[model samples]
Target chain A: MIRRFGSSQVSALLVGLVAVAAFAATYGFDPVPDGLPGLGAVEFPRLVCLLLAGMAVLLFLQESPPHDPETAPPIGRDAWMIFAACLAAVPLMATIGMLGTIAVFLVVAGRLWGETRWPLLVGVSLGMTAVIWLVFVKIFRLTLPGGWLFGG
Target chain B: MEAFLGGLAILLDPYVMLMVLLGTVLGIFVGALPGISGSTTIALLLPMTISMGPVPAICFLGAIYCAANFGGSITAIMVNAPGDPSASATALEGFKMAEKGQAGLALGMSAISSAIGGIVSIVVLIFAAPLLARAAYSFGPPEYFALALFGLSMCAAIGGDSALKNLMAAALGLLIATVGMDLTTGVERYAFGVMELSDGIGFVPVLIGLFAVGEMLDQATRRFGKPAIIALDAARVPGMAEMRKCWRSIWIGSGIGTFIGALPALGATTAALIGYNETKRWSKHQHEFGHGSIEGVAGPEAANNAAVGGSMVPTLALGIPGSATTAIILAGLIVQGVRPGPHLFTEQPTLLYAVFASMLAANIFYLVMGLTMAKFFARISLIPPAFLWPSVFALSLIGAYGPNQSMGDVWVMLAAGVVGLLFRRAGFSPAPLIMGLVLGGMVEETLKQSLLIFGDDLTGFLHRPIAMTLIVVTLAGLSWPLVARLLRGVRGARA
Candidate 1:
């Protein structure tokens, strides 16, 4: 017979499965040398994995309720958009530089988040970039990467 | 006396004081804004503080922490939006008081009681931390291991939606902590061919991602409609007569907040909640509750602010952070190469004293600011999330990179942000995971040392009295819930 699982059960099952996988991966770790009087790298992690697995199984059986904060709303399309933009910025930082990346991210994010005016987006984008340049680069003297396109 | 005087001197210095002022201003600003909390702000600013000396850096962060608790009450009172989670208790009656056109009175009570509570807790911190540190001199590896375990055991109880999920998050953190080369075996475990991972995950990046960028993503999920503004008089400070009415509750809240906050893994939010409850339990005007209750505002506001100082005790003395904000502060301490513990009091007494002084000063600053400029600070809540959050995202990316100047760290930050998003959706607290990450290395190191010293005999832990005592305490704490349940079942059967 097949059993249907709820979110909490799914969560617990996933955690237990990952812990078991990690327990399996411990074997790939090198063993402690004979003369060394200390633990192998996997000893502590291995112990933790077992504990986690045990706890997950218990949780699965218990079928606890989700502890969502009172204020938090469900993740919407906008969150995914922001997450994607954030991920895209990391690679873009190498190609387009810090300022360029910041500007691109702000404009794209602002527009996508439903801002109508181009001038306002451009203002916020450039304004933020300049403020950061002054604070981090000029006044604080922090190093920001110039990217492969422009040398710092 | 010399250390105390030296600390006061640091507070008196123009540069340090300026930074403290800046931190206080920024703290109130962000603390009065919903969706941007003090913890997130501290994480965002951590990298920028790398150039500053540790003393100023700590003072800046400390000032923000102290002021923010009070600042959170501003939004809670004005709009029923608690800018900081700690002020949720305040929002209940405070918003009612606002509806009753007693916003000024409630705001006044919150400020005065918050100042008194904050000062009381700082006084406790000043005396309590050094005494707590002295006890640490007797602790050995096994003792520390037990202490770490005791801390981890509490993770199931603190700040989370579910106990099991909190434990899972912490386990995940411990896994993350094990990514670098092992200090004992000189063997790499899970670097996965990444050079940055060889040194282990950088605390700064992880913290930035978890608190700042993660919060930004959470903010992105939905739009905030503006709450109706409650008009309040900034000049209407709580009068002497009003103070007399709330005197008992202010003290009760302060005492409870300090005591709860000193406990491992507890913080201001819990303190304020209990404070609110106890204040109701003991209040003469119980009828005033759930309406426009000035005592309600006073109790929780004081409790949360008091907790700010109380939480510092463990973070500074035991290196076990009592709250998420203190966790960030502890990370800052570590980032500045200042290892916190018993030795710190002896080695850096002046610095410790300065931190205490700055916290004291911050309490006073926010009280004055909260009372006078609250009307203005309340307006900050009106700032559009569209403008505010995008700026935060930009800064988060830069802040993540500023630490190691490596794109890899930025990549890690982004990944952690996703993890943070998942964590929120899954109903987990990031605090336990942070606690696990912070204590993971020490737990392994101490356990290894204990084993080496004991010749791999697990029973050797039985010989260390302090360690044994801590282990027993941990066992009891973890079992108490089950014991209570069993007792209840037996009683029901008998009845």
Candidate 2:
């Protein structure tokens, strides 16, 4: 039988409900018009809640198993490292033009993906970055961030 | 006809032609790259194109949208990585063909089918839009609400998983859409005093975050999976024999895509999915599916391309975006001081014609580029995930921030990425949410207007033939699956 109370569904339901309730508590007023036909924003959320509640009930009754742990795909080690590094890069991207950010990301990615040949990897990565950079800057005239180092 | 010829003349000018070709080539390259989608490509380019003549810019963006929609299939087939979600189904069969050393044939089939679907859709759009616009001229709010309801119901009915879930997602989307100021009452509903929330979350940021960043997170989880080693050789174009095999699928899929695209709120992804499902349902060898069936590739690729064309219909005829990308494109049009409603055809016939011409030209360019670049683009599949994910993630941020140059948008991307990941884990498809957001305002505004006109009597919908027709069709659409399931159950019981 499917486990409806799996952590994922429970979390989603909780977050979604909390979000709705927070909105209601903060901005909501009582006496939302009753017997309102399905028209306008006033009626829309009421219907939405009915639908969500019904879905929650359906989830409870379904026979699907919680995600099968045995068949679960591995969250690769390299992916985690890359994700962490990329998150670090988001704030820095404004200082570095897209090309610069791409260059660093490519080099890091190549290493993490286990490309032994650095020369080929770096060459292709930089080549693509340069092409995109030149196109955006020269042809399209869109100004990508000029990294602090590049001095525009 | 004279207007069409005049429009054609304007599109054929050397400058317009050059831009179309350039846009098509650029679109193909960008689309072939993983992590970049047609919407981002257009968003990045639209700002630059704004200063140019609007006709040329429309033509340029048109080419990009058309070619990019087709270009995504290249990565899908070669690397088993879909460059865009629309091409995900294509990868199912296209990647299998590559595994079987038929990468060239697969590429060729996709190119031809994409070209055919694109051309057919443009033709239909060119002819059908004017007629539809004429019909829409008589439509008031009730008609529009009925139309939007029909569209939303179609998504709920046809979504592959539970109808309840799709409705929930769409309902949630509609609710989220209402979180800003109420247009009628001029009072805030859910903004909670956040000024940014007052604008109600700009569409571009939300889209980039949900679709693009969410996609990256999903891809990141697969980082450790074994990469497929495609034996890269000169990719061959599919021979005429194979083309003939999938021609029927291409036609049916294109028709399906165009029809779905013509529907408000439905996008290329929906069309592609529906086409793929329908192809599998109708095929004699459904068992061969999920294992590199050529029909699988042809059907989805065709549908998506056609859907691109289909989406333009509402934008031009009714000022509504049929899909997210088109919605962005519509915003771009408005930024350029062009109105994209039915008035556009009468007011800006040359621009409309130019768009049509660019769409037609994009197909030709897509065919040419796909044939020549198949071998070269296939090499991208071999690029490792470490480098790929970071670069893609970075690009997603840049693309997300490009439209308005807002930092808030970047945060939106991050939040959307997290939310998207949560939704994915919870087995919720983001497609319905997208449909809901795109159509939500229209549903609200239209329903409000309809109620003002009809005064709480929904039976007023039956007074209008077109509205009544849509309502009937929506009911049929919702019930078809249930009826089919019931018949299947009866047969199983007898067995």
Candidate 3:
């Protein structure tokens, strides 16, 4: 017989499965040296994985109520857009440099968050990026990505 | 006494004084903004402190820590959006007071009580930390192992709604902590052939992702309804009569805050909740609760601020963080090459005392700054999220990259951000997970050493009385919820 699971249960199950995979990966560790002290590199991780899997199983068994309408609003398209933009900025930083990526990211994020005026968006995005560059890179002397394209 | 005087002199330096003032103001501004916490502020500032002297760096962070608690209450009172989770109880009564046009009075009460609480706790920390360190000086590997275990277990117990979920998150954290080369065996465990992974996951980047970026992502997804416009024209210092009325509640809350803050795992949020409840129970005007009572504002504000002092006790004496913010501070100390624990008190007595002195000065600054700026700060809640959050995101990105200058760390941050959002959605808090990761290395090393000494004999733990008692306490703490439920069930049946 097949059993249906809720979203929460499915998430728990996925976590448990991941733990099992990690547990299995521990087999590749070099065998413990003869008469060498306590449990080695693999033992503690193995134990943690076992406990994680067990707890995940228990979490899967617990029933949770469906989301209420007043709270827990559905994840909207704009939210996903913002998340994608953030994720994209990581790789973009490698190509365009920190300042360049941040300038573009701020504009895109502002637009996604419902800012309508193009001039304000452009000004704010560039202004914020410039201020951060001055403080973090110039004054503080901290290194930010210079991009492979810039000969950095 | 000389140490104390030396600490005061360090704080009084022109450069150090500037750092404290700037840190406190910045901390308040950031703390007043919804979705940013003192921990996140410290995380963002961590890399910048690398170039600073040890005394100035810690003093700066300590000023931020003390002031941020008060800063959180500003937005909580004005807009019903708590700047920190610990300020939620304050929001309940504070917002009501705002609606009734007592916003200024409520702000005054919170500021004053927070100052009182902070000062009281700093006193406790000054006296208690060295004594605790003196006691911890006798601890061997077995005792350290048991203490670490107790901390981890208590975190799981006190964190989030689900004990099982907290444990699972902590276990995941421990697993992550084991990613680098094993310190004992000198063998790579989970590096997966990546060069960066061999050095272990960078905690600073993870912290930025979890607290700052994750929060920004969560904020982007939701709708913030129109916030109340609090008029601060009437805002002023609490009158003598009002102060007289609320002093007792403030005192009691401070006491509660100090006690809870000293314990592992528990934090100001818990202290505030208990303080609020107790004040309500003992209040003569019980009807005033949830409807703009001065006592209501004073109680939780005092407690949470007092907890800052209380938490520093364990952090300095035992090298165990009492909260997520302190965990980051402890990380900052490690990055600065100053190991915290008993030796710190003995070896660097002036540094320890300097931190204490800085906190005392910060409380006075917070009171002055909070009251003087209440009018201006009340208007900050009106800032559009569209403008505010993007700036925050940019800062978070830079903050994550600042520590190691690794694009790899940035990628790790992005991944951690996604994971953090998913965990929050799944009803797991990141606090216990953080505690696990921070304490995991110490726990493993100490446990292994203890086992090596005992030759794998489980019964040998009983030879160390302190270790044995700590182990028993951990077990009892882990079982507390279940035991409480069972007792309630039996009592209900009899009824």
Alpha carbon lDDT of each predicted model:
0.86, 0.74, 0.85
Candidate 3 residue pairs that clash: none
- The DockQ of each candidate is 0.63, 0.32, 0.65
How do all models score by TM-score? 0.96, 0.82, 0.97
- Candidate 1 residue pairs that clash: none
| Residue B266 displacement (Å), model 1 | 0.5
What part of the reference interface contacts, as a 0 to 1 fraction, does candidate 3 reproduce?
0.64
Cα lDDT tens digits for candidate 1, B16-71: 89889888988899898887777888888888788889999999999999888888
Cα miss at B100, model 2 (Å)? 5.4
Q: Give each prediction's root-mean-square deviation over alpha carbons.
A: 1.9, 4.8, 1.8
Model 3, runs deviating above 4 Å: A1-3, A33-35, A68-72, A149-151, B157-159
Roughly what TM-score does model 2 have, to 2 decimal places? 0.82
Candidate 2 wrong stretches, greater than 4 Å: A1-4, A15-19, A22-57, A64-152, B13-15, B34-54, B80-102, B157-161, B224-250, B264-304, B319-339, B456-459, B479-495
Q: TM-score: which is higher, 2 or 3?
A: 3
The 10-residue segment with the lowest total lDDT in model 1 chain B: B226-235
